[model samples]
Target: MIKLPKILKYPNFSRLYYAGLTSELGSFVTETALMLLVFKLSEGDKSKLGIIRASFLFFLTMGSLLGGPIGEKFNRRNVLIFANIIRIPIITVLFFSKDFYSILLVNAMVAFFTGIYNPSRQAMINDIVPQKEISIANSLFGSTMAILHMVGPFIGALVFSKMQGIDEILTFDLITYFLGIALISTINYRPPKKESVDNVQTSLFYDLKEGLRYAQKREDLRALLFNCSIAGFCIGVLIPLLLPFVTEVLHLSDREYGLMLSVFGLGGFFGGIISHRLTSKHRPGKLIVSSIAFEPLLMLLWLLIPVFIPNLIIFFFWGVIVFIRIPSQLNYVSETVETEYLSRIHSILDLSFVVPNISGGIIIAFIGNSFTTMEMLFCTAILFVILIFFKMFTSSSKALFKSEAKRVTRDQSIQDGIA
Candidate 1:
């Protein structure tokens, strides 16, 4: 057996890790359950299902937008605990919801709180871990979530197979949340110093605008955000269409679909491990950009390849590439940005996906029913490929160079101060 890192030995981080693990496991279960429920409620109407999903995302985005300041200003631990606590009742309501709209409403509410939970948790992680160890921390954190994502679906499948209803799964989800609350309560954390009462308070709008101004001033931050935004848009387009592609285009069974998903998650787990081990030696930004750039080409390949086995193989690798960049990507942000502004920055980045998620279906719909699925996919792939290269080479090249120089200078200053 491999020896555990010394960081894992820290009781507080360990507790926090377990809390996240349980919460993620539960979320995945709920995710699977929600998907199934939506399918049932919509009677497998793809359009309606999309609407439900979009609804949840809309509220989530709004929550994230508003939650950023709260995370930055408040006690993150309390915020996290409250977020989890509030979710219980919301999920409980979801359990008993018989109507589709009720389910949608409850889900939206839950997602709203989730938006709060996520940034608070992320900010808290930065507080708990030292700057030097962030990469390892993220890798371990990413790996745990990936593994849970891989297994949770199976657990959901098993439970669904046994119970054949959403109720039992919801109950399990509630229990997991409770456990998460219990686990996280034990963690010791310190919030930043409060602003002096004598100082004039900035309005929320002012604070938000300030964050935007800060981001705008940094060419690298802007470039990175642009890259992330594009990536999120492309990903959003792919997510809603994956099930249909697997079932209709690939002609795969539900079992095969589940297997494909599991394999994909497994790939993510390995990718996280590799990222952790290689962080010191590798150019993470390059690796991340390269992986995302390759995604379109990979999708195109998956679409063109007629063989199911080959497609699964391609998809597994796709998963690896998808998750492999997360730790690096996040580490880059944490390393580049000031701690005081990190949560707001995360919230801003979260919008990249949120906007795309809400608009993806509309984009798909406007293209006309006459186009074949393959044609649409092909066009999307080509567009993403072009856009990605253009963004990297034309738009962000100078920014990246500037950011690198700035980072070096900052590091030197810090070292000089220490010396």
Candidate 2:
């Protein structure tokens, strides 16, 4: 077994972790509150909710596109700080918005900053942690996100229910952003100076083109991105369906539904722990492919089995297996790709995940009554299974996997030699 280094021992990583924790915790509350606010403002009109969400998502995708260049071309820490600072007032104004359109405008602005924030924050992780320790860093970060997802909604709901207004919660979220900025500003990181030969000036579009070319040249990286994109789409489709399945299909109460999410979070927490230990032991290519393949099978099983206890168990592992591979995926990128392209690749990957997310609503709307939700789930799961198998066995994928295994071996040998 490969031993993992302690991530918290690094002061900068610790600060980033705490900042992320606070930020995500606040996000959970903010997201829940925003949804409630939208529902209230629209008088329970579901179509309006969709419009609001789509507006935010549209700008978020745009933000991510711009984030790549902004993150790579500037000081990442300052970029992150600016991102947070910009969000504070935007969210603050959300509380005072008189109409849904005003709220939508604010949401768009916040999301644009978010696109900038996420890539810069990710780049910061790649910057502060050494390649060997990147997996641990990502593991810790991924775990925090999982934990937030588990209880953040419940907490957000609770606050919204009790306070009877979005203002307090919005203020709280603003404070967390403030805290994130403060904590992040304290990290002692000096950005690396740009290195170039022949002094060629490159436009942002040029950088984006070059990044795409770089990803295209590496079979392994392309395979990883393609597989992740498919998996992300599946996740997007399934996520919104979970609540409906729990409430309607299982006939479970809200409290029970919350517990189920908590259990999933617990599974993710443990998975993060397990991932830290296994990250060094496994080959990245195999780990990523196997985990991606495993999830759809679980989703299919979820549709087949209707019993609550069995479904609960499945959800637990669903969280575990899915979260476990994320750190490994990020670690693979960190180790295999050169540092110069980290921000660009991260932004590209981020866009891949978000772009598919919008399709989930379409999937839900399309299959709403044609088949039962569970049946739809089964069909989607099967679709993912077919896609994964086909992709894995394809000529390009096979070559990618083979070359990736060799690269992992070479990288490990170098790390061991250094140790």
Candidate 3:
């Protein structure tokens, strides 16, 4: 008999979790389909891939800027539903988009609405799950995301190879959004107690201002947002580099490429489990900094040893570090941020990531072709190291590490006394 994760025992959370699984799977599928479609349409112009991704993510960033305010000011459930509904036409337009520019435009539109959906959904976790279970909840969400990220793209690619048409793929994506809407509708949420008629009456602009102010007032959040920007840039650089590295450097086929992602996803799945189990034992911030700091070092090492099997092992470890970082970061935020500002703060975090993510795409687009994949990857490693060094110096990180140090010292003192 299987025992469910404790977080999943909550009825509302279970429903929302399953709903997220469906929507997230569709989202990854759509992303893969769009990438393939644009690649073919542009005659394998790798630069265009960067352009499409950057544009898609740019609008997502912009939309997120507004999404936080909108989600907080209006009914969150309604916000998610409306975002899903409006996205239908956007995905439909992809069927008609033939040129690179048109495809980019349609994808950007889709990203914007999807962006709106993300913050609301992230913040919604608080409404459905108990406060004590937040870490487990985040870990579960992270694991689902890792699994879907691998499986969804693999499914999309398999279908595309067989059908050899973007239209069918687009239709599949559209259907999923409808399913997402249906699932979202079924979720019953408990609105925040801080939400009152008076507070709700405030203008979206006012809420937006307050959200920014809230983040501005907090040093820890400011550091986290800054860290996000650095991660964003590294992520931007990594995305365009991965396929080329696997295929060109490793001299492997598409199947090998998929296997690489599968291995990473497997690592991420276990990482989430490890993170969830450790929630009771370690500080979230300690887990976050420890996991995140070591990740880039693995990236640096991966570049040094380029054989396929060894690199597969490396990718797995990288994935574990990532999953550890993700849940710990989310848990940290949940503990600190007020429920009222949760959506907006998440939106800000998204923007911090996406803005540099767009820049990363552009870097790969222009600077990438000039260098070999290995060389470009080395540059990525350098950026990641820089990001980590930045993390070590942040005030929040110091405090987190300090707290862990004190705990260890106290534990040792008690053992000495017993002896």
Best model per lDDT: 3
List the candidates' TM-scores in order: 0.90, 0.87, 0.90
lDDT of 2 by residue, 9-95 (tens): 777877878898898888777776666666666654544544555566668878988888788888888988898898887887876
Error of 1 at 314 (Å): 1.3
lDDT of each: 0.71, 0.74, 0.76
**What global local distance difference test value does model 1 have?**
0.71
Separately for all candidates shown, the number of backbone clashes (residues 3 or more apart, or on different chains) is 0, 0, 0
Candidate 1's TM-score reads 0.90
| Candidate 1 lDDT, 81-191, residue by residue in tens | 999999998888865565888877887898898888887787677767766666788889878777886787767756665676778888888888899899888876667
Q: Which stretches of model 1 miss by more than 4 angstroms?
A: 1-3, 194-198, 362-375, 395-398, 401-419
lDDT of 3 by residue, 163-213 (tens): 777787677777877887887787665455554765447776677778889
When sorted by lDDT, best at the front, the candidate numbers are 3, 2, 1
As for model 1, its CA RMSD to the true structure in angstroms is 4.0
What is the Å distance of residue 168 in model 1 from its true position?
1.9
